[model samples]
Target: MNTAKSTLVACCQLAPKIGDLAYNRSLTERAIRSAALRGAQVVVLPELVQSGYLFADRNEALALAETRDGPTLRLWQALARELNLVVVGGFCEHLGGDDLANSAALIDAQGVRAVYRKAHLWDAEKEIFTAGSEAPPVIETVHGRIGMLICYDLEFPEWVRLPALAGADLLCAPVNWPDGPRPQTERPAEVLRVQANASVNRLFIAACDRYGHERGVGWVQGSVIVDADGYPVAGPAEQGGEQILLATLNLAEARNKRISERNDLHRDRRPHLYGMDSSLD
Candidate 1:
């Protein structure tokens, strides 16, 4: 296996206006260019970046949704080629007919590499989008094996573990975190969850979240980049503003899931003893 020496990852936190495709595209493009100029090999943007979140209804979401070969993604493909970097971001995906899915696409110089539809829908999203059936795939790239999940998927431990078992070096999460209570000194609970997931999997996690209020909904702007040890390397950025968090990660280190000589996060799993049948009952 060809392990990456080191890869610079960036998470872009920006507020997208609801129903404003052009403005969102401009913001996304500028962020991508800026991150690329800063030597980021992989740049991740917030969920529903092009179409924005907080849609009023299913009809409104469908109006903003784009197909896989749509203009927004085409622009990303062009930028990926020009910048020679990988870009991962979320969008409202049109799945033909009346179907729409909240999806994230991984784009590189060669074009769209993989697309992951959000498997778990949250709140009003359940009313506007269809849940994706497939799990995120581990994609091979020059930098490393990349996996993806959207906002709510990160909450599921099984979802995170699947990618780790598949040998993913990095997990990109495009999120639109809703506002919630947090302690004065402690990080947001969502940020802590990503850190724990990254630490347990021994992989890097870059969560790109948006800030500000949209359509009467407030967001938690706790974008972060966590290393294999489950510590924040870059953010937990301030709320209600745009920010970019950058960090260089050793992809090779993620391949080592062993905490010590006797323990391995992956190898030590006792699936047989977990009683899957009983859990189902």
Candidate 2:
């Protein structure tokens, strides 16, 4: 039997229907229970897994947006406590009145820990949601120190660096990657970026993506769990439609930043020089 240092992580790649809150909630409950049965201590679901992507309009998105105390998150909190697992998933957040946000919640047995709103809006999302201003949240859990972020946010290396610097051992990302053209025999760039982020930060990353076409749009369905070395310990799950990807990680390994015994990834960074006229991000 393995020890406590190992954390079993799972990425549930499901196809959520648009504008159907009840169905999405039920689907996530099932997925969470199933992952728990399979020994997943950290379970991740796709971005907007609670509300689905591809809103026809802001009205539809607003209709789907829910508060932190909404039913979906409430269910997750219950499941996290009952199954004794950490859940990181996404939803369309209702921010009072007419404002809405694309956000994710980090919940453990103690209940909702942190909510991260997508800081970088994508495409039509600009019109439908308000971009978040805060950085990704990192929290300590029974399993390990875990951090969270959403899709598209992964594209910025600078942003991903924040959680790593905060002493997070694992970073959970909920993404809904729209399908696009790429080399047929090669891997998707989406998966490649997850690996790059993991290796560069010396942190483990679990990215869960959704599948199926919505409003003539198909996704990469690329749910993955990457190790600190940037290699996949579980899945790329690209094109694998509706599935769960799991990997048991020794989260403690991420603490060691040594690559060649001489070079350290974090210590070597020179961000102060990256800015224009010494004032930059």
Q: 253 in model 1: Cα distance from truth in Å?
A: 0.7
Off by over 4 Å in 2: 1-4, 276-281
The per-residue C-alpha lDDT of model 1 at residue 279 equals 32
Clashing pairs in 1: none
What are the RMSDs of all candidates, in order? 2.4, 2.3
lDDT of each: 0.91, 0.92
Query: How many times do residue backbones clash in model 2?
Result: 0
**TM-score to true structure, per model:** 0.96, 0.96
Give the per-residue lDDT of model 1 (tens digit) for 1-281: 45657899999998888898999899999999999989999999999998999888999999999987998999999999999999999999999999999999999999999999999999999998999989798899889999999999999998888888888999999999998777877778999899999998899999999986888788888899889999988988858489889999888889998999899888777765765443322
Candidate 1, residue 145: CA error in Å? Answer: 0.3
User: Which digits, one per residue and each the tens of the lDDT, describe model 2 over residues 189-216?
Assistant: 9999999999998999999999978999
Q: By TM-score, how accurate is candidate 1?
A: 0.96
